[model samples]
Every structure is written in structure tokens, then in C-alpha cells.
Target: SGAVHFTRNNLSAYIRSNVRYLVALLVAGFDPSSGPELHYIDPFGSSVPIRYGGHGSGINFCTPIFEEFYKPTLDKRTAYNIIQKCVAEIQKRLVINLRNFDVFVIGREGITKLDPINQVSLRAQLMGNPPPRK
Candidate 1:
């Protein structure tokens, strides 16, 4: 919670100083005493706790997928699979192309980084399209 407040303050100060840029931040982690935490910090530095959230241009595309699929008790494999599904949906639906993504898992053990996913490749797999030629 302190971290979230600090981030909100920093963002608020930055926006106050620069007035020309808008940015939102997502802070997520695993807390030992409390389990999982996800906070969406808006451009004005207002922070809201959320179970599942997305930021920036892809939020519209990703949020619905998350809402439809997210479960608090998801296992690692299921969570990763849902992430892939979200990415695939975004690639297919969004106007701008996003090529790759880095995935991390925050859990009881701590943050675990996974192999990055190439959105094009994953989209092809999800959609039954041919893979990019090697």
C-alpha cells in the first residue's frame, strides 16, 4: 500500500510538472500476509485496487478478456494460458500491431519471469493460421 501511494505521488508530481503527458501505471505483486495485490494508478495519481486490470491502449481489448476469464484461484498454467488468450485477442482486435510480450508470475515464492511470447506467433497458434516462416 505504501509503495502504491509513493507511486501515485510520483506520478502526480510528474504530471504536475509536465502537464503535457498522460500516463497510467499498473502495480502488481504477491504480498506474503495478504496474498496477491493489483492496483491501477491513473494519470491523475488516483490508485484503485483491482483483481484484474490493464493499462494504456490495450486496456479496452484486454479488460473484457480478463473479466470473462479471470479467477482468483487460478493455477500458474491456467493463468499463463489466459494471458496468452488475452494477447491473442488484442492482436486480432486492436488496430495497432503489438509484436511481443514479457510475462511474469507473482506468487507465494516471488516473481517468476517466463519466456517472452511473440504475439504474432501466439496469435497464429490461437487462430489456426500458419506460423511465420523461419
Candidate 2:
């Protein structure tokens, strides 16, 4: 797919030209001919297509969760649950306190934004407890 190749190449070139800047990205799309696609472009210009990937400070925490739960044919609800778990684990284990996350889905119909999930509330919900007092 030329579009996919072009996107990766363009990001690689951009990262190369802007060495001083941090430019990590997760590029996801739905190609009419190929279905869903996901790519991760790192700060060093290296890019690779992935079934599931995470970036930034919380990536290390999130990757294992994705690896354990990700399925190629997972349902939307199940996928959302995995993401919530990832955010929750990040909040719990990562030194940095990252709380809010914006979620979106790319499919045959195009991109759809889902409700933002808060790590604190999600963590409590997953634990079968109430949200922590502020």
C-alpha cells in the first residue's frame, strides 16, 4: 500500500530533519483494500506496523497488557476493556501520574471518537470499588 509506505517514509524523514524534537506517533487507519492498519513511528525515525502498541512514558507498562489481551478479532467492548486496563495499570505502576486518555477507533466506516476514560475512575471501577476521594 503506497499510502502506508508514504506515511511511514514521511514520518521517518520528518524525524530525521527534526533531530532536536521528540516525534513519536501511532498511526492508525482503515484501508479500503486491506482493512485496519496500525503503525508506530519512534523518535529515531524507525517505523513498524503493529497489531497493538503504546508510546511515551507509559508504553512499557502498557505493552505487556496489550500482549496478554489483544486478539485480532476482539469485539469493540472487549477492546475498550483492554484499553481501560492499560490506562489503569499505567496510573498504578508508572512513576508519572497520567490520568486522562482520549480514545478513538478506526474502522471500515472511518474514525470514531469514544468517550474519554479517566484512569482513576477506571481503576476503581475495575477493582469493584468507588472512585477515590479527591
Best by TM-score: 1
Give the per-residue lDDT of model 2 (tens digit) for 1-134: 45557766776676667445567787788888878989877766577789998767788988888899998999776787788888878777888766688878889877877766795568577678744321
Could you tell me how far off, in angstroms, the CA of residue 101 lies in candidate 2 after the best superposition? 0.7
The lDDT for every candidate, in the order shown, is: 0.78, 0.76
The numbered model that scores best in lDDT is: 1
Residue 26 in candidate 2, Cα distance off native in Å: 1.8
lDDT of 1 by residue, 21-72 (tens): 4777789887778988999888788999999887667778888888988998
Q: lDDT of candidate 2?
A: 0.76
Cα error, candidate 1, residue 69 (Å) = 1.0
Clashing pairs in 1: none
